[model samples]
Target: MRRPSTSILFIYGLAITLLAFIYRDPYSLLLISIPNAVAGIYLGYRRAKLIVVLLLLSIWGTFLNAYFLANHGQVVAVLGPLVIREGAVRATAQIGLRLLAIAGAALIFIGGAEPEQIIRDLEAELRLPKTITFSLAYALRLIPLLRRDYSEIMFCRRQRGYRRIAYLPGDIKTLLLPLLSIAYQRAIWAGITVELRGFRKRRPRYRRPRIGLVEALLLSWLALQVVLPIMAGWTM
Candidate 1:
């Protein structure tokens, strides 16, 4: 199937995230996310893997924090109905499912989208300011370069017999400063290159995007997912 345009995907992703926030019920959130999760798996398994990892970490962290706050530093409560800790569990589960929904939608929409294409669509279809669009595009383009640089840095460190320690603080102390410096240098170089190229004066002409049946159907489905729940009083 032909993927929807970046603009439509972006909008749909935002709508899905908004729905996740609006609906507090964990089951409702999970139900809404199922379609997006299926789409993400079908459309972009490689892209979805990173998101899945992040989602797991986020859920664990949120659950721990919520549990601590609910228990007020007490031990874990016994598993029983009508307990105060039950509220914490419910809250944490709801948050985790909500995050899952948002991440799944992002994987479905942005996993296959090119930064250049999104920039073009924003500039052309949304009539966004060129400066904003170009700046965002530049940052997005730098992500892969930064990832490669990080790998190189790690390789160099290993070559110098600098093995990573088990402690998180030690790891951060060893890695963070060097990575920050590299990022700063790259940013400076990118700024200079853009300035020298007269980036401000260059006007990029974008072709208006055509929306077809596929896009229309996708949008309709997303609309139903969000709107029907509220209309039926399933979500507040």
Candidate 2:
């Protein structure tokens, strides 16, 4: 049998969120947050990591600020706000750690997913409405399509009496209009293609696949994702 795909991992991760809704616990919420951020990193790369780290920092910072507000009672004197105070620093540290944990979790799942697999699973396995599924599939393709169009637009602008100079609005001006126009055209074309491809067709009945060993294991993990957060929150 073929190995379980990246889409499955993402689904597993998403299951965690549903679990969070079912059980509101700060501790479990924090636990779930870590995996979500890590999943983002895993899906992308350095960019994902950067995003997750920033997020963790932000959360930890908030906690630090809370601590300071409760304990230090804000710094105010003849100087009028002496460099934010120690609590501020501590808050920042807390936020940083939370963000790091989130980033780590995102990285784990993102590394395991493939864009193609994700699209296919969303389209077929998930039994999402056809129209929405197709829209998402097209959206996944948009990044590359936009990049290619942008490159072509830039090249054309450069040829048409537009020289790119450092630190100048002229560089952006040369390409922006054409890029916008191309993007609009592409979006229209994609919409038409999807419409013609019967994406809006009536929902077709699908035969569910029997849960295999791997799927069963993944499902179990997902179930745990739901249970753990609430349990953590309750216990904490």
Best by TM-score: 1
CA lDDT of each candidate? Answer: 0.70, 0.55
lDDT at residue 140 of model 2 (Cα atoms)? 49
- Residue pairs in clash, model 1: none
Q: Across residues 1-236, which tens digit of lDDT does each residue of candidate 2 receive? A: 54555456656655554554443344655665555555556555642333443354356446545545733535532235444545554454444444444444445444554556555565566676766655545654665666567567657766776764312344544555676787789889878886797766746554444457766777786677666655655642
Q: What local lDDT score does residue 115 receive in model 2, on the 0 to 100 scale?
A: 51
TM-scores for all candidates?
A: 0.72, 0.51
Per model, state how many residue pairs clash. Answer: 0, 21
Where does model 2 exceed 4 Å of error? 1-10, 19-24, 46-124, 146-185, 201-205, 233-236
Quality of model 2 by C-alpha lDDT: 0.55
